[model samples]
Target: MARIIHALSEIAQDYDALFCDLWGCVHDGVRALPEAVAALQDYRANGGSVVLVTNAPRQRASVQRQIEELGVPADAWDSIATSGDAARAALFTGAVGRKVWFVGQPHDEVFFEPMKLIEDPVAIERVALDEAEGIVCCGPFDPHAHPDEMRPQLEAAKARGLPLLCANPDVVVDRGESREWCAGALADLYEHMGGRSLYFGKPHAPIYDLARRRLTALEKDIPDARILCVGDGIATDVKGALGEDLDSIFIAGGLAAAETKTEKDPDPDALHAYLQREKIAPTYAMGKLR
Candidate 1:
């Protein structure tokens, strides 16, 4: 069972650091949540470190730029660990073969940029699906369209035995009241349709490893017991924390607001039912990040 809390300050002293999710917890896609930002700033001021662990399918630098534009200040976090960086390393090492087909928006083309870290990297080429050996997905070409629309392409890739490298494992994200489909929806469909798909983000081990590396780079050797994972995602954030054997604080006000009946706090009965359905138990639950 998950204990519902009113604010992060109630247990802030117990953790030395936080692995916080960005999209729905800290920000709502359009701008930073002021209360959430204040809570993080106060935590850092009191000597606690914050690592913004995100499943955004873009480079850390790119995420930084986007968050800055969306009103997230620099003082709120100590470091960043993005799904893009982890996936990029795998992509460069030939996780998806040389000639591949890409399925994403124009902005996601940066995924093909040269990597300086991988030694003797594979020479990747973005070619047509007919000429490609694998598929790389950052997101859907049209985020608003239904996932079923991608069936034709996925079937073709399955017949050719092409594996999909999913940059983000989130099925959907609420971008300021407008929900949008993500790359994971397509990858899930592909796997369901008998094609292979690879994931490096939340609920997967690779991104957690990348987050620990980010923590080490900052000289913070905080133990597992002293670290807390905070996010709104039940499957991605909370599940990832459980898989890593870390305590988690689920923000019910983010993605599961309706299911949990959250406004200022979650309705206990509703939250209990929702958690029971998902079969995931976080250490704590809050209406919002604050």
Candidate 2:
């Protein structure tokens, strides 16, 4: 197994573009990770493309606003993409006027409310999957609740041939205080049952393609070899980069490690195990971007 490094300031100088993860690498929900933010700022100062891709359930614009509010340096990235933006586009391009059902936490309304949606899901009594045209899912019914809690909905949506649009493509998240499942898990289940799903965020080709297009617009031609993805989660961050055939730098102190009870620090063994399971390894692994 490859060893994880505690600091990686040297590697920053070699990359032309930095594809970063936002929630875990740059912030811990409430406050920004100063080191990670600074690393990005420093990288950008040296003329590197910094693109922050998040699996957040909100649009890219909303995420930018949030980043500004969190004190993340405004110029940290050259572009941004979110699962929400992709999900919305997927819906708009799909069959229109399709009655939709949303299953997510309370805050997820921001992602769907702008669409002039048919109904607010929280108000519905006994959500009837058979009666709906589609489902706009932002998260699991309970982040921590087991998959069985979602089985009924997934089975019903699949049986009805309802398209599931997952705004937050993340299957799990470090909720600042604890680990909880996100919308991605339910969407996966629905897909497993033969239901089609549209994912909007990181690790997905559309999102990466959007970021690559922005990078090209910034410069003449950006080589994939020069682009590097930095993220915390194995599924979204590492796997996302792998799918795109881009090098990734894993952050152990980010969202994927949020459930730890001890003081936050990078764990090498855990990272190696994660990499082994994936059958692919990141170019580097560090505690934080700083």
**Every model's TM-score:** 0.99, 0.84
Please, what are the lDDT tens digits per residue for candidate 2 over residues 77-157?
Answer: 778867776676666555313567778778677775444333332332224566777788888767889766778768877
In candidate 2, which residue pairs clash? 83-200, 203-240
lDDT of each: 0.95, 0.73
For model 1, where is the 10-residue window of minimal lDDT?
Answer: 108-117
Candidate 1 backbone overlaps, count = 0
lDDT, model 1: 0.95
Q: Which candidate ranks first by lDDT, i.e. highest?
A: 1
Q: Per-residue lDDT tens digits of candidate 1, residues 92-117?
A: 99998999999999999888888798
